[model samples]
Target: MATGWAGDGAVQDQIDATVEDAVKRARNQLKKGPGLTHCEECDAPIPAARREAVPGVRLCVACQSAHDEEAAFSGYNRRGSKDSQLR
Candidate 1:
């Protein structure tokens, strides 16, 4: 049944949209083809063990750590605040 002003399937549509967006983001992050032998950012040699452990790896430990730090601070919140809940 419809809730509030939205139609019957409105909540489901929102859920579907959120899932689709997450999948799209994940797919974009996935690496295709073989893993790089060197770090693309710092040009450091990516260890053989790393390459083997993580298929399609591109960055070395240092560069990957920096990249992870940057990504963590990218300010994209998957969930909004309670203000959004009031909607």
Candidate 2:
């Protein structure tokens, strides 16, 4: 109901915004078509197994790992918890 200074529905607003943002990010990360034969980032050949396993995969395993690591520090408070804000 009331969220003090934020007023009514503020928490819900934040939740909705977070969910929308996550959906947008997920959509952006998804590949539009079949996986590439080579890694887009490093120009290495993509393993057939990986291509089959993950449709539309663009980066090879090593590049994907590095991308994942970088994504982990994307500077967004994905969790959006109060504790995370405090840190």
Candidate 3:
């Protein structure tokens, strides 16, 4: 049922990459540094709820949203592969 580059490590690669990204992101999220403060970017109050919800959380909600908007990286499963060639 796959089509185009969808067949080139398509589903499996995407799934694997997703899992990998999740693991990496989870690792980063789990990492905690000394902190209890406001958002450096927007000076918004870092809610206790958010600090608790995300252990090492930085950036308030608004700042986080804006940062996400500005983040330039693509998702983990975006491209097929460098070695892949369309034909």
Candidate 4:
């Protein structure tokens, strides 16, 4: 049962929306087209194995790691919980 102003199944709807957003984000991040032999950011050579493993690979391992680290922190909270909104 939903409390206060929330309608029935509101929590489930929120959960499903969050999951859908995550899925869309993941899909958008997927690389497309041909893989590059060199790292676009560092100009380092990308190994053949990596190119084969990750189709449309652009960055070398080091650059990709750095990129991933940079993208790890997300300031926006998609869930928009009451506690988070208060802060």
Identify the leading candidate in terms of TM-score. 4
lDDT of 1 by residue, 1-87 (tens): 539899889999999999999999998888766789989988988888888888799889998898899878844445877866676
What's the TM-score of each model vs. the native?
A: 0.51, 0.52, 0.48, 0.56
Indicate whether candidate 2 or candidate 3 has the larger lDDT. Answer: 2
Candidate 1 positional error at 84, Å: 9.6
* Per-residue C-alpha lDDT of model 4 across residues 26-64, encoded as one tens digit per residue: 988988777998899989999999998898999999999
Models ranked on TM-score: 4, 2, 1, 3
- The alpha-carbon deviation from the true structure for residue 68 of candidate 1, after best TM-score superposition, in angstroms, is 0.8
Off by over 4 Å in 2: 1-29, 74-87
lDDT winner: 4
- In candidate 2 the C-alpha lDDT for residue 73 amounts to 87
Flag regions of model 4 displaced more than 4 Å: 1-29, 76-83
For all candidates in order, the CA lDDT equals: 0.86, 0.89, 0.76, 0.91
User: Which is superior by TM-score, 2 or 4?
Assistant: 4
Candidate 1 local lDDT, residue 64: 87
Worst 10 residues of 2 by lDDT: 1-10
1-87 in candidate 2: lDDT tens per residue? 555789687888999999999999998987776899999889999989988889899999999999899877866778789988898
